[model samples]
Target: MSEATHTTEILIVGAGPSGLALAVDLARRGARTLVVDRAAALFPGSRGKGMQPRTLEVLDDLGVLDAVRAAGGPAPVGMVWSEGSRQGELRMFDVSEPTEAEPYQGLWLIPQWRTQQILLARLRELGGDVTFDRELTGLAQDADGVTASFATGPEVRARYAVAADGGRSTVRRLLGIGMTGETVDPSPTLVADVRVPALDRDNWHLFPPAGETGFMAICPLPGTEDFQLTANFPDPDTVVDLSPDGIRKAVTARSHLAPEDVTEVRWASDFRPRAALADRFREGRVFLAGDAAHVHSPAGGQGLNTSVQDAYNLGWKLGAVLRGDADEALLDTYEEERRPVAAAMLGLSTRVHRGEERRGRATQQLGLGYRDSALCVDTRDSIPPDALHAGDRAPDGHRGGVRLFDTFRGPHWTLLTVGTAPATDLPPLKNVRPAHIPPYEAYGTGVFLVRPDGYVGWAGETPTGLTDYAAAAGLA
Candidate 1:
């Protein structure tokens, strides 16, 4: 830590979904970014088997949706069973008309590993690379920049360094950030990705004939010749051999099938749900996002989706600060806007893990928002009583016949006109582009001004100064 001399606009630690997602944004903005991970290779397993539509939107922005779509199969049509009979199909449908505002209808069941591959491939395409065996061993943030030493012996000096590591993030620990939450011990379950000849296609059939040992599985793997079986292990301490035979035994024991009928074991592991978050997301020029910043149960299949969105919230702010278009204060919004979401996600994850239903949930879907945001005005009155709540994201509904998405892209800002000031009323900024729309004229489609990162800037009605909406975007 002797005043190491390395430099980059930004340095990202960890190559998980969060790190890679931020790298995708920063590199896209032409920010000189360097990403490092401790693992030599990406995770190779079936973790986070569900992908919500919101995540698909964020991935689409990063330009990897197609790759992920091609590599993975379709959204899971949720299933529930008790005995040999279907108890019910969890209501997992779009229920809304297709519009640019929000196109994806429900969650898809693609394993997390495929997502990592798609993101890594996209990062490479953007000229960004993740150096592995490179760990963040030390960090020191002064007035000028953040100096970090890598276990690899090299050092990096970045204007801003992000710790997207994980629950036990070395950077978060080095910075002395603490997470708050309790660990929920569900029945420890064994999950293995293997190929059993006659298995798969019943695709996620939860078994045990109602009273036996509940086991769920048949996750389809395209090129691989196997199924991913998830079963409640009688003993949490016992490790599943993960061999072909071990998996076959688990599958057959629960499904009452023939032993030889199962063949070819591919991969396996055990998992338990946990919910937690760092005491803070930012510490000087160094910050944290993703699992390194927060963790929650995989309930409602929100884990990966939440982490990716966390990076999504932080990326543009990091890029803007690096480019000198915005102050470091902008970075403050990451935690402000995302903390609540993560906290809510933790609850949703719990609900999902417990098999909760998702019907006409609420505007919080994508409607999750930030009233303290710089872009949102205080005209809370005009905000239809049914519109949204303080920490809720403004609905992606149409306003003034414009798509809330696609309309706001890249580094430019927009003036969301809803009976408030027009884009013409806004002052000149090198990157901000004003867009105005009337509120009453704007309904089901009210004006929802969004930043490049996808958080609400200003919603509801006319405010004194739209830039005031922007200043609060992060902090003063």
Candidate 2:
């Protein structure tokens, strides 16, 4: 290690989607953040390929949704094949049309690498860049800050730290945190990115289990000529091969294509599906995010989406606390809110892996919220069960010539008036944007205090307790 020392407001211990996403959010908020990765470069594999609608909204707020859309298209329909013959078409997700509230519907297909590249670009645009090949070796946290030592670079000290490292998180281990989980599948699976020019790029080709081999799927990766290949091994003890020749041989044996048809193997790996969650998310000044906090089976395409959301949930709170816009107690909500959601998503992933649930609205994650959280304050009578409430996601709409999402964008809380004006003088708060819209059935009628992350933190028929809520939230 070098004798020099580096300091920042926040230290992030991974450059994957979660870390990069959090860095982007923090950068846009003018927070000094440092993101470091053990690997020499961004991830190269095509793992975690599907981006849900909620994530699209997140990217939109991060100012990278257009790039993400240009990099990928919707997931193609599955086409089963046997003996070089085509079978009927099968839909992967329960499709839905875009609505005023939910503009992004269905799953978008893009490789994990492309998504990370988009995030990194946005981070750079915000004057933040990730440091590569800086492997964390030690961590110690005091009441005031955290110190992280690297193997070959200068040690980093920051007021706060986050572990965006993957499932085998060194930071989590350093903190003595234990994860409780189970293997979702006993069989090992192989996934790879390869180029097969002979295979049509329109449909996701699938093959049923034959003589000895399990199922195989080859899906085209949008915006790229490569295809992602997935194969299953029924025997848990089978040692799968990951080399180019091995991938070509597996492709030839499973599908009608010959070994020569698989011209290139970009990347490959194998894993047994598993679901795990950390015993806790925070320990003193450090917090766990992404796969460091939870691991999913990837069946419902929930792992990456959930991980990104973990960053989204923590980013604003960290920024608010660091900027002195909120009380230090505001940070407690990170774990209070995200743990239950992670636990529920883990169960959903396991069920989807076992064919018990379909990739539908539940997988979209728009309904996930903090309704039962301590931060939620809904002081209204005769509230309908179906009406949007405090802690629910603030819906998007165009009313009174104003678009709700556009007003909610950025790292600021929004005081939104829907079909009602404040009956009393509104309390002044720092970094809080105000907007008023005509009556919209999605939100009914109320004065909602939207959090920086786009959830309604407080709602009421009028601005009765708004001042107290603002002070408690540390925005006074």
Candidate 3:
């Protein structure tokens, strides 16, 4: 490796959803960022294909939602088959409609490859790009910054570094962070992307376990002439064949379709479902996000969504501290607020994988929040339990002439006054957007200080403690 050194404000150690999302966020804020991926190119498989409602909102704020929506469609209804005969349709999830508070009420289906492409495009539009083929070999951090050495390139020194490098992360290993949890399912499962011109795209074809074989499903991928096939094996130690013929045989044996119907196998992999969380999210100047911090079963489609939200939670804080606008302590909240959320989502995914839970509102992630975090400051004493409070997701709606989401779309904190205005003097702060609207039931009567990640960081009947809260939150 070359002995030369390169520097950036932030070094992101993956180009997946989490790293790419963080790159986009930091780029938009004019923070110098470098995203490095060990892979030669973006991941090509259709893994993590489901986009939860909350992720759609995050993509929107990243300025790639239009492209994402145009490139994807809603998940199809499940069509079961048995003994070479078609069965009735099965609803995979409880259907929901868009509400004022939750504009994206249902799941969206876009292949993971396509989502990465969209994010890469948006990053380029913002004057940022990822460096491929750069594998992190070692990492060292001090009180001032982090230095990451690569296998084939010059070492990178950054003010901070984040590991979004998947479940078996090199960064996490280098930091000696241990993951704790259990194997959700011991049965090895095969997931592949294939082309089947004979398959209908309207429904996700499902085949129940027959005799000694396990279950299988073939779902058509939207905006492409491909389908994603998944099959389970009864034995945990069984070796999965990833060849085209193997995939064809797996489909032929499990489903009503013939091996010849599977015209092409684009990509394939196999894994046993597991749930694990890192012992800690941060080691000095290095932080872990996405799969590096937590692994899920992928049953409830929470892995990628939770991972992306981790980036959303950390991006603004990194930007704030790097830009000298906030105290470095703000960075500590990234793990504080996200670790519990990851743990809960892990349980949810495991339950869904075991058929003990349904893909409903919980899977949507719209109700997830950080109400109990150290950053949440709820000054009002008589607020109801169900009412919106500090650390709750700020609802999106149109009250008066301002659309709440539209106002919260950028990289800035928003002071939303609902049914009431400030009763005391406000502090001067940069990149903090303030808006006042007439009384709205969703927010009740108060001044809500919304974080850049669209969560209410502080709430009060008036602005008596708003300035102090802002200072403590690294906003003032």
Give the TM-scores of the predictions, in the order they appear: 0.85, 0.98, 0.98
Q: Rate the local accuracy (lDDT) of all candidates.
A: 0.68, 0.92, 0.92
**Candidate 2 local lDDT, 1-476, one digit each (tens):** 24588989999999999999999999988899999999999999989999999999999998999999999999999999998889889887897899999998999999999999999999999999999999999998888999999899789989999999999999999999999999999999999999999999999999989998888999999999999999999989989999998888788778889999999999999999999999999999999999999998988999899889999999999998988877888889999999999999999999999999999999999989998999999999889888999999988889999999999999889999889875347656888888988889999888999998899999998888889999998888
Q: Between the candidate structures 1 and 2, which one is better when assessed by TM-score?
A: 2
Candidate 1 per-residue lDDT, tens place, 365-412, comes to 565566655434554555555555333443354556765555665655
Clashing pairs in model 3, backbone N/Cα/C closer than 3 A: none
Whole-model alpha-carbon lDDT for candidate 1: 0.68
Q: Give residue 187's lDDT in candidate 3 (0 to 100).
A: 95
Candidate closer to the true structure by lDDT (higher is better), 1 or 3: 3
